[model samples]
Target: MTALRIALLGAESTGKSTLAQALHETLPVLTGLRVARVDEYLREWCDREGRTPRADEQRAIVEEQERRADALAVGHDVLIADTTGLMPALYSEYLFADTSLAAPAHHAHRRYHLSLLMATDLPWVADGMRDGPHAQAPVDRLLRRWLREGGHAFVVVQGQGPQRLEQALNAITPLLKDRAAALPPTSPSTVGKPASGGLFSRLLDRQARLPGSTRWTCELCDDPACEHALKSALPPATPRVP
Candidate 1:
């Protein structure tokens, strides 16, 4: 099975991360496919350091997000990314007045099957790193424009808590059902940035695995990876090696 890479996107104070977590937890149960999650690295990096990122650091932040998501995609049947490379790109454009990050960010987005934009409807919460509610609307508008102008089809997520989660699930179900047809063919238009024979490529293989074909296993459970699980509908993997 080809892993469906789903990115939760939006401005700060939105429920992007929360929805990512909720979807990560619930998606596997519904899809019967193992899910791997790429968490937002910016927040973790910010909390570790003492401040928010400057213009130059934006590139690194975006790269790290792609790195995390790519690594998770190696083994899981579905990749749930809290945010995409778009965040850093937006930050550079908004705060630092730089658009250089956009190209790399768009390329990073091409790897995913879908990006869901989280709505800024919920009450804003201060996590120490957030730039406050003032930045929300503008940032949301900017992100929407970025996604639209980039020729990317993105779904907008609304509501609160469980309702929001249900909305995301509803959006994803059809994608999963038609994932094989939805996935891009192995060509330049759909090729991921990772190199051939790299750790990531060696594990996941590509979309449309035939019966008796080898499939990637849970990397954490075994060594040297790429263990086949015969032919199951989903990428054949368990939480642990059997």
Candidate 2:
């Protein structure tokens, strides 16, 4: 029972936090897996910094989030991180601006076992702490970057509340099931090498065994012109959580 690190990522006002909370509630009942949000880490970082963070401080925030995610992944059976506005690919663009900062140092994407990408289909809301109106385009760009980087993610589009919930469940349930099947069935463990075979070998086996129909596909705009239109569609962004 290795811990599954699920990361909820997207641009500002895309409902990452709400979806994380909902998944935190629903996933355990359906799969007996726990979910922890990254907000707890962000709140602690804000307290240490003495104020809410600004956009320029994104790299620092992401670093801290990664650290917290690592720590939680160590303790929990399953951890779901509510990412900052930027996805891991976009975060790398900012963190590795200086060539001296080698690629391995900013390996945020490597931390997660699964990523839930909230799509920008709903109206952009200016929540008191949210920073931008041009969130949709950046979100779209980031989603493309995630796909290009070979990251595993699913899009969640805006819809009626229940529909959005079901969409989220549908997107992640199979992943959870697959991960569960891969586990040793003895005790909760970290998501790394298994006792008999290493992580890489297990990963390759999974890929080799994947059903052809389990491939990625976009649920939004049917237009063939959409870049990465073959990538998996995300679940809709839900409202902000209280």
Best-matching candidate per TM-score:
1
Tens digits of per-residue lDDT, candidate 2, 19-85, equal: 7788788665555445566663554655677765555565565566667777777656677777632
Candidate 1 segments whose C-alpha is farther than 4 A from its true place: 180-242
How accurate locally, in lDDT, is each candidate? 0.68, 0.53
Error of 2 at 105 (Å): 7.2
Error of 1 at 134 (Å): 0.6
Each prediction's number of clashing residue pairs: 0, 10
- List pairs with backbone clashes in candidate 1: none
Q: List TM-scores for all candidates, in order.
A: 0.73, 0.64
C-alpha root-mean-square deviation, candidate 2:
9.0
